[model samples]
Target: MTEVQTLEAPSARRPSASKAPRTTKSTANLGEGFAARVLSVLSEHQRIALRLRHGEGLSPEQVAARMKLPQGVTDRLLADAERTLQAARRAFVEALVENAASRD
Candidate 1:
């Protein structure tokens, strides 16, 4: 009768992309947090609208001329920016809820 001996071998594990850590440069925040991330992903027109109207406090007419956008279009752009920010806020809240749930 022959006796068989079992040998243990080390298991090789590969690191997952999801498990990789993000560097600071790749994950810079323009605003406070996730809310900022959502808000920052705006179209050029939307960003210009925000910069002119809020950042520089420019008049509608001036902003329209400087940005080469119609006055009515600039108004719409401002409204769009507001809408984008509100939507971003909702998304941020949802993300927080999801993250919290995952932790639990």
Candidate 2:
């Protein structure tokens, strides 16, 4: 006598497809005009590189690819942008101190 065997398919439903990827904004409660000042201190390339690196949270390699620039060039652009913003921040702080003192 031959024995009969049966196979059962799984009954559980698969999970739904994930939603589209969402890009995150760089600033969260940044001071008014602060981002503008940071961008203003940088050249066009520097600004774009900085945003891609920090704002979009991309790796240096990714930033370079997106900008169509060599990785070394993108690195230099980010460094330059950082230095410029640092100087601007120092100057802005000094000006704010002076303004506050004059009001007293």
Candidate 3:
């Protein structure tokens, strides 16, 4: 007879302290700075979408109803805002890297 083995799911297992993710002061600061920059550069529609979804903790359907826009349009607006923020973050990080390189 052949021996049978079973494997546990990853989520069912507990991670060791050393394997846990760490959030340092610098990492937190970087996240805050990135968010601030993204907000500053967002278009009016993007700003509204972010504010409704995050600031007020509203669902996308609720945001659409509040904005009096179609659900599809609201979804597009949210997606666009996310894309814009990601692009801004990339640019901000690149600028920081370039500045550091220049100083070296």
Candidate 4:
């Protein structure tokens, strides 16, 4: 007699599909206004970067060392933060446009 090996599907380890779909949709919506909110929320990091680059007059490499982040990673994070802020601003503008269009 041979014993059969049972394999679990990947889906079994994940959340229920029914909930995941809705969560994904909400995440997309959150991403729409996420940048601006993130900027407002993480103002301290921005301040640190500003201080390092302007106030202390440190280069990105120096800033990365001081911040204890990898130089390339720090650069990417800063750029992403800026882009996220821009995305949030764009989302806000788009919302205002939709609201105005609805009024008309």
Candidate 5:
């Protein structure tokens, strides 16, 4: 009888726990932090506009009626608030990226 040859597979190695990347906080935490910072920078009118339109889920016309302001005025306030929020979001993202890059 011919001799049989067998080969054994090598054992897999587990990644070291200390070498794994660590996560600081969840996205929800980051979002809440960003929101708090944005709120700190927003004007009273802008905060009120955001609360009425987003928190209360009111239509632009409804917001205008509730505030007793003209549709045009409400529209302007909403637009300005939206712009402020966009700028803040961009700044926040840029700062986060910069921080991560610095860490790396």
Candidate 6:
């Protein structure tokens, strides 16, 4: 799942990707924590949508067919999943900052 996510998630790309610069150990740790959190919040359907769409690098139409959903619904589902992930990411960063600040 982590490998699949790295395929399309540019911001959360794995350090092994040639296009992305090598990530520091601490940065990678933080990203892992965030990814775990995001996965925990996602529904089973949403996770499947993301894995099919981004992980497989499939088109909306293809994802729809595989998911047995209408193309429009697939598109909307993908969008919603992305929005959820973004929100979770923001919260994760905020929490990290708060933790650091409190420790200081």
lDDT of each: 0.68, 0.69, 0.75, 0.62, 0.75, 0.77
Q: Worst lDDT window (10 residues) for model 2?
A: 20-29
Backbone clashes (count) for model 5: 0
Candidate 1, 19-85: lDDT as tens digits: 6444354234522565456556777788877788777878889889999978999889878877777
Candidate 4 local Cα displacement, residue 15, angstroms: 51
lDDT of 3 by residue, 1-104 (tens): 11113579867976798975466787679867777766777777778877888778889999999999999999998898877766776787687668657966
Better of 3 and 4 by TM-score: 3
Model 5: residue 32 alpha-carbon error in angstroms: 3.7
The stretch of ten residues in a row with the least summed lDDT in candidate 6 is 1-10
Among these predictions, the greatest lDDT belongs to 6
lDDT of 2 by residue, 1-104 (tens): 11113456688555555643222352223323665766765788987887787778789999999999999999999888777777766776576667557966
True-structure Cα RMSD, model 6: 7.0
Q: Mind sharing the TM-score for model 1?
A: 0.54
lDDT over C-alpha atoms for residue 102 of model 3: 92
Tens-place lDDT per residue, model 4, 1-95, is 11113578867775677744343465567655554355466557665764576567788888899999888877876676556555656776596
Q: Largest TM-score belongs to which candidate?
A: 5
Pull out the clashing pairs in model 3: none
Candidates 1 and 6: which is better by TM-score?
6
* Candidate with the larger TM-score of 1 and 5: 5
Residue 63 CA error for candidate 3 (Å)?
0.8
Instruction: Quote each prediction's TM-score.
Output: 0.54, 0.62, 0.60, 0.43, 0.67, 0.64
